[model samples]
Target: MKYQKVLIVLLTICFTGWVSLSCHTNESGGGELNDGLIGYWKLDGDGIDYSGNNLHAELIRSRKRPDSGSTNDTEHNDAWHQVSASSNLKMDDDFSISVWIDALSPDRDVSGDIISQYDVGRRKGFHLSLTTNPSPTGVGNSRRLSFGMDNNIASEWMDCGRPGQALLAFGLAEYNGDLYASTCEPEAGGAGHVYRYDSENNTWKDCGAPDRSNTVFALTEYKGALYAATGKYRVAGSSLPESENTQIGGRIFRYEGAENWVECGQLPGVEAIMGLVVYQGELYASSLYSPGLFKYEADNTWTRCSTPDGKRIQSFGVYDGHLFATSYDLGHVYRFDGTEWVDCDQVGQNNTQTYGFSVYQGELYVSSWPSGKVYAYEDIKQWRDVGRLGEELEVMGLIVYNGQLLGGTLPMAEAYRYQGDTTWQRMDQLDTTENVKYRRAWTMTEHAGRVYCSTLPSGHIYAYKAGETVAWRKSFPEGWHHVVVSKSANKLSLYVGGELVDQKSIPTSDSYHLSSGSPFNIGFGQHDVFQGRIKELRMYNRVLTKHQIDVLGSPD
Candidate 1:
């Protein structure tokens, strides 16, 4: 009888150990590290959660097919997988997401979301994606992998002081992790000098004027160097008083450090350089008053490229494998294919100019003048109205920040965030200078983790740190790359290819209760629809340790 009792106890102990081992063992080789794993999608052929959990995701197409040139492929544009909201998928505490991505059409002008479960209306949840938008504080190689969270609160704007006696902070750029601004100072003997922002002291350090021009019109980064374009801006164009300085300016200069710039030659027959961008691997510039687009060559030479409908192009952006240019003539957006230009036609019936471009929620969006409204690109020449900024005449800077699309407006100099379905929420009036005919929140850029906006009349820069974002400030490499986003305790960390790349601290008051009832998106979110292939997606209800993450990121 004693032997029988002992044998029964031993059998029970063995069975309990076997069950525990089965629960902890991961088929992917992370032994005893599968605790709190809620979902695991291999995405080999379908969205089946192979972790013995029945959280299957449904693939859905969010946009209608084009009337012509449809491929009818299963993974077409706007196609993404959706997992229904469930209690287990609701990350109300610590969580981790790991996935592998292979971007298909990676362009310098485009960005797309990888995975997210964010609600733009309520302003809550988390988002992870690739970002390539321009910010005021940082300049070159702006493409990065960004992970952000919405804390259900908007940050107040911080004043970064004005840059000398400048009337307008005409342009902003980020270069080598530093923030620089170009100004428009039309006073006699006051040229438009480039100033670097001193964050530690809340001041501006003059980097000297590149030319005897009223405005340092544009800034860009190419080949690991900072470049500035000059312009003789006429303040009377904005209904402001005419300047005493009238020097002709269409010069380009390369930064050689503090208070020094090297001339890179000037554009012939061009009085002002309106825009500058680095497309593909070359530098391109546009003329403000002439119908010309010039490409930089070796040894201070520039070759003029074919113009779109002989129209003047003012601002430039890249998307969908083509270089897109906004027109200063007919409110048209054009696409360039190196040899020729294809006009996308006018954006709105009444608007006469398109100012800037931004990517939001898997689509291209542009801001317009006269109407002061924003429009989303539906197809070639097809635009959907996205409402107008309140009582504003022109919208200039369009950028994506903190999982939301934001635009800066003229006249009122206000900023607004896009909610869903043509709704916009006013954020703040950046410039409060009164008795001015036009106050502009002119240019913007992102640096460090904050969105900075430069204002006209005041020339003061305002910064907003919305939520928390950690960005890998380099171009996402080609082929497949491993990415991990982990929110543990009060810290959020990003790991790329099994190495820690960037991190940011969550507010102590943040509960991080990401219980937004929105569906978990796999290849789409609040940004452009993902233009890539995703596989081996895993979500854990608990934070993943570095060792466990490294093992998963390793090759088989």
Candidate 2:
């Protein structure tokens, strides 16, 4: 009851041997749960993995022990990660990643050795970590970057101290002379310093505003830009401040150039902005304490994208031509197809994990939290349990490149790549992992016989050419949300939204340039199966001019 600001209840009713998704549809007025369950025949269908009583019993047991502090409760927390076995989780020119999480610990004391200790003396709940690779210590240590609640106030903890360090929030990024400071623990300096590793020089440098008191709760890179939201005030290297004023406010900011972290936008009505993403050429922000999603247009404006039925969004990802967001309340996955949002949790038989999501090889892949199992779904309303991976590894970001599905893990900066069926390869062997710790490949792009993966928190980019062991890396001027590589007769063209951002040309033989596939396999490479949606797909065997590319953006 401490933080139950919103309650989302989903009920199941059985009437006349029929399983209804609603207990009292008229009373709730939330709409029908399942319209296809009206009539029931004998249990017979294709691609339906019915575990009979076993799955049913597991679900029942989970519901009965909802208050248990076991990992099972957290395993199913809808904060899981995803990986692909084939192609990358491709998004339409626009997409967003949304996630909801129930914070487990508000205090930094986790009953373990103090590898890192820089607490801002606030309530730091749900710490999210980020680090640089090759590690500053040169032994591949996890330079974790975690975001948590400090003193009932949302703050961030940088693991620059150790594998699991907790640094307190000193201040916010402001343009004026005075830096934003916490009301409590005024002795600590505002504008906390974050270390961004310069891979070329192999050294850590202080980035972000120095000597400010703005607390950035959530950070994301959208459309070649870095965005952060301010929430909950607390002093660095301390505990929860006793003032209610520092514990109850929120704001949003975006980094301009390299040092000036200015306020770009704000979540007006929402209580706390948890996540931000760029979908369908527009920016989307998710609020953990609210049921709706907001979008930012090209003209720099925000609007509510859609309102869910009181479900808290845990995480969001864009695949194929639709937008997918996970719900923490009842393991529901919602898909936005540029229109109304459709509840497709039934895709996983109501037992699906709502945390991790990815789109790979034309299929929507979901990795369940706590449970640590992965499932692939042709449809989000119906999921197919594939198999299990590592135990207790909370899978987060999933990407596919060069015929392999890659996944990012927490606590451990090591990432795994799925090789074919039942084969998992360590991604750290590649040279790219040498410079990134806790690198979540949120954005993956392929162009000119090479795959590009960008890591979060560090904002570094790495490109792996075909048959190459080491990745050619670079730093972005701004964090990029999504990357698109368009090919016109063997020539590579890149575009964001409808504008061309990056491009290159590759020489091709006659066999490579003249090949054509139906439906034009837009999301995942060239595949026959249509697992995801195709918004606007066009393939040309012959080279098209710049005018033609513009026409593709607007068909006549």
Candidate 3:
């Protein structure tokens, strides 16, 4: 009986040791390397955390699809998995988040979050997403992967100097890592000129006028080259005296180099090229005064697409594999699926026109005229009025900057950042021109780590370096891609499929403590809900070495 008891004790000890070993081993039959792993979720059939950390996530408003490899399955924007905030999940200075995702093509012109734990109210924490629009410096492209973080501090606004004797910096675009602005210079011998911003010298280098028109209204990048659109902007629209320059400008031009432009022909029966956008590998342009929508075919060639109800369209955006346009007529929003235009109905009963569109936190928001109100898109023909921007009469430029939705208003020339439901906090009065009948904080773009806005009347470019974001600036490509984001010391690094794609340094003084109190999200955060399938999400409390990340990202 004594010998039998001793044998039982030995067996029990061996059994306990085997159980401990099994807990450390991953489901893929790997061990030892996942030492700092605090959470590992194999979202195969559920949100169970297999890291033995009990950090299981909860699915909220999520629906399972057959994984058809396209966005045609169903709307996944409302779905996400949430893990409760815990001590282990609160990252310090060094940490990493790695995941495998099969991102679906966006159904709207908006960025979608992959993984995040952010507090939009406080503007703190970190997020990884895919951008559907260009950044201010024009360094990154649409559909590029981006990672950003907010340190809970207000950024100082800097005046980036005026672009010539221009009344307005009409449009902004980025090309070849350089920032360019198109101006409406009504001064004598000051026809619309495109100026390149020299960041090192903090001055605008005149790239000469693309046309004799009074305004170079719009700018876009297409097929590795910069394109500019011209307009004979009616100053009367701003309650200002009409300019003597009567040069017609319904033409488009391609930038050749320093002080040179190549004519790309003119739009038939159109007076101004109001907006330009690239949708599904093709360039599309809108007419300012006419109900015309044309697609670029070749140099000096364009094909006219059917306009929505024969109504004029203005600002262009892309979402959900379709093109979206704000109307200069009827104030309605329209969606074009590369074939027919679907009327999205008017924004508000009192508003006369819609100016710009931005996607924030999985919903589309638009700025309106007359009412100066911003509306969030809910469903077909449905919009919820978020709020009005102070006492302004018109709201123009709308963009998602540093995890917040911001709008530029006319008359006051003020910029307001969204602060949740029906609440907006004024950031600043960008255009401080005294006694002007109408002043406008007109257009905006993101570049480097700053948000830049142009002002009418002042014609000055103002920039605020807010949160830091590093982007890949290229399409993320189809199929499952392994993505890893890591923060070590004062630098953020992004790795895709085991290769370092981009890296940027963060200020050491900035707060890197990522304990935002927000729940750790798997498919949702600051941007829209992810429209894709995610699996094998792992979070570590320490920076992962390149070799470790490579081994994990390698195809099985």
TM-score of 3: 0.86
lDDT of 1 by residue, 21-136 (tens): 66545534555456778899888768898766788989876663253233322232457788998876867788888998876544444547788888887888888887667432
Better of 1 and 3 by TM-score: 1
Q: Note the Cα lDDT for every prediction shown.
A: 0.80, 0.35, 0.79
**Candidate 3 global CA lDDT score:** 0.79
Model 3, 163-208: lDDT tens per residue? 9888888787656556789988875555989998888899999999
What C-alpha RMSD separates each model from the true structure?
A: 6.3, 23.3, 7.6
Runs with alpha carbons beyond 4 Å of true place in candidate 2: 1-197, 209-225, 230-250, 269-271, 297-301, 346-353, 410-414, 422-556
Model 3 error, position 243 (Å): 2.7
Say which prediction, candidate 1 or candidate 2, comes out ahead on lDDT.
Answer: 1
**Per-residue lDDT over 162-236 for candidate 2, one digit per residue giving the tens place of the 0 to 100 score:** 101112221111111111111111223333233343324533344554224333444444444555554443332
